[model samples]
Target: MNTRILIILALIIAGIAGWFFQQQGKISPPVNIEASEVDYEATDIKAVQTNEQGETEYELNAESLTHNPVTNQDEMSGITMNWEPSDEQRYRIEAGSAAINQQTGELHLSGGFTLVSEDKVSENKTAATDIEPIQVTGQTLKGNTKSRQVYSNEPVKVVQGMNRFEASSMKANLETGEYEFGKVAVTFTPVERQNKALF
Candidate 1:
């Protein structure tokens, strides 16, 4: 009887230990993670236009465009362009969001678009440069083709000589060499002498 009792106690202890071991095995370890999911989308797309003289004259669907006042750099995304050059004064242009540099005059364009010219004279001139490469900087549009006047019905900012203007919308008539700014306020930097006089 003593032997039987000891055997029974050992069996119970073993069963309990086995059950404990099974429970321990069933527990899952904590998961370790250092990163999470991220979602990104494109924003602020626009189109722009300019003349053979390198003046920005028009823009279409002009939203999400930004200009650095200090750097004189202009950037636009999502573009559709049309250009027509006149018969006289042969002209050339380089444009793109990536190509724009106030200091260097390089326009960078992205999103894969074409630089087209409708004018015969302009097309001949453009053939010289292989229709200027549109440089792209992070999906932005840029560059001008030689034979075509740049056209965009989007909102636009124009830097013509000493004058800077922006409009809710714009249209450039390359044939007539004229640009119409939608009813909008234009801004320009004051001359240094004029600013000094005010102070």
Candidate 2:
């Protein structure tokens, strides 16, 4: 498959923040905490976002979360998120640590992160067994929900089927399915041709 076709994985994962923006807006802003202190804290957190049609857009979970009143920021650890853009595809995102500025829509993901994209299974077939999933991994990422943009300055890796790609840096538009990379290297598995008996 062309690497360009793999851009979907990046776009779907970038959309992770789009649903997160809704959750951020719903959480009450912190109050009465000192500038250097966190006003709210929680463990084993789970947040879900749904569309107007009552369909789930994304679900987010974290091992722990803390809110800074002064910065209007939420810091979380052991984060995992699942996003469903449509009935055909699903994306899973995991991160070690993240911080989001609810007010500014700024997001910072660090301590490594991984995103996997797969087709949804239907009554006719098992998607997981039939189709290969695409995986994207990186050390650090930054983005803005409002802008629907995500980028990484650290090395990034993507794998699908027998294909692998590595890039020194990457930038992608969440809405447009466009990607840009700096210093990319790709390794593709050779296709095997079946022998045909000459008639």
lDDT of each: 0.46, 0.80
Tell me the tens digit of each residue's lDDT in model 1 across 11-129: 99999999999988874677787543322223455555566587654344423456655556555554443333455322223233332454554455554433322323444465443
lDDT, candidate 2, 55-158, per-residue tens: 88778899999998877889999999786655665778789998988667688889999867756775777544666776779999898755657789999998
lDDT of 2: 0.80
Candidate 2 collision pairs: none
Provide the lDDT at 130 for model 1.
30
Estimated TM-score for each candidate: 0.28, 0.65
Q: Report model 2's TM-score to 2 decimal places.
A: 0.65
